[model samples]
Target: MKVLQNYIKATNTHNFEEVRKSLHPNAVYFFSDQTCTTHEEIQAYFENGWSIVQEESYQAKNVNWLYSGSDSATCTYTYFYEGYIDGKTISGRGRATNIFVKESDEWLLIHEHLSPLPK
Candidate 1:
């Protein structure tokens, strides 16, 4: 629960630095429209928002969770994301499954896969 909370905070604030803390150095991120294989790439993707966009809301759902050990877990959830670009609201809501691994006593995201919800 606490790890998820920190992840949300890092996302909402667009705090890449904080986000990095929760990400494995070689995390794999498969988004609705793109895939990133490294923390730096993900950071760059979010960094773009600071210059041309703003997040309006981000909501998570499903929340099916499991723990494999003190250092490993898998979380399945849906995310509803809304953002503004050039004053226009763009929304993308989808289901996501993420695998998290604790490294050095810190939970770090190791992999994520996101898919669009059926209309």
Candidate 2:
């Protein structure tokens, strides 16, 4: 969906405000190490990640929409990320699930869960 694409673009910008524009007010995020249920927590988590991973670029691959309705949609994808961490180049792939809902005639990301891919 366009919203999902926009969200990914926003993330690449590494600007929290731009990213926040794509999220629902009450959005929740599940990361490999922690869960964020509040906007403040989510913002902190994203900022911290960006700080650690300089010039990080993230992408979603093989996205499959598990469910799509008039008001809501859910999708799963392989997420790839690469960047420099502590002056060393690092890259990884993970599994991601995102849930979005239509609100005020626009789609907003409500929930996202990301986990490390299995060996």
- Could you tell me which 10 consecutive residues in candidate 2 have the lowest summed lDDT? 1-10
| lDDT: worst 10-residue window of model 1 | 49-58
Off by over 4 Å in 1: 49-52
User: Which residue pairs does candidate 1 place in steric collision?
Assistant: none
How many clashing residue pairs, candidate 2? 0
lDDT per residue as tens, model 2, 15-92: 999998989998999999999998899999999999999999999999999999999999999999999988999999
**Residue 113, model 1, lDDT:** 88
* lDDT of candidate 1 over 18-62, digit per residue (tens): 778788887998977788887778888778755566865666777
Q: What is the Å distance of residue 98 in model 2 from its true position? A: 0.1
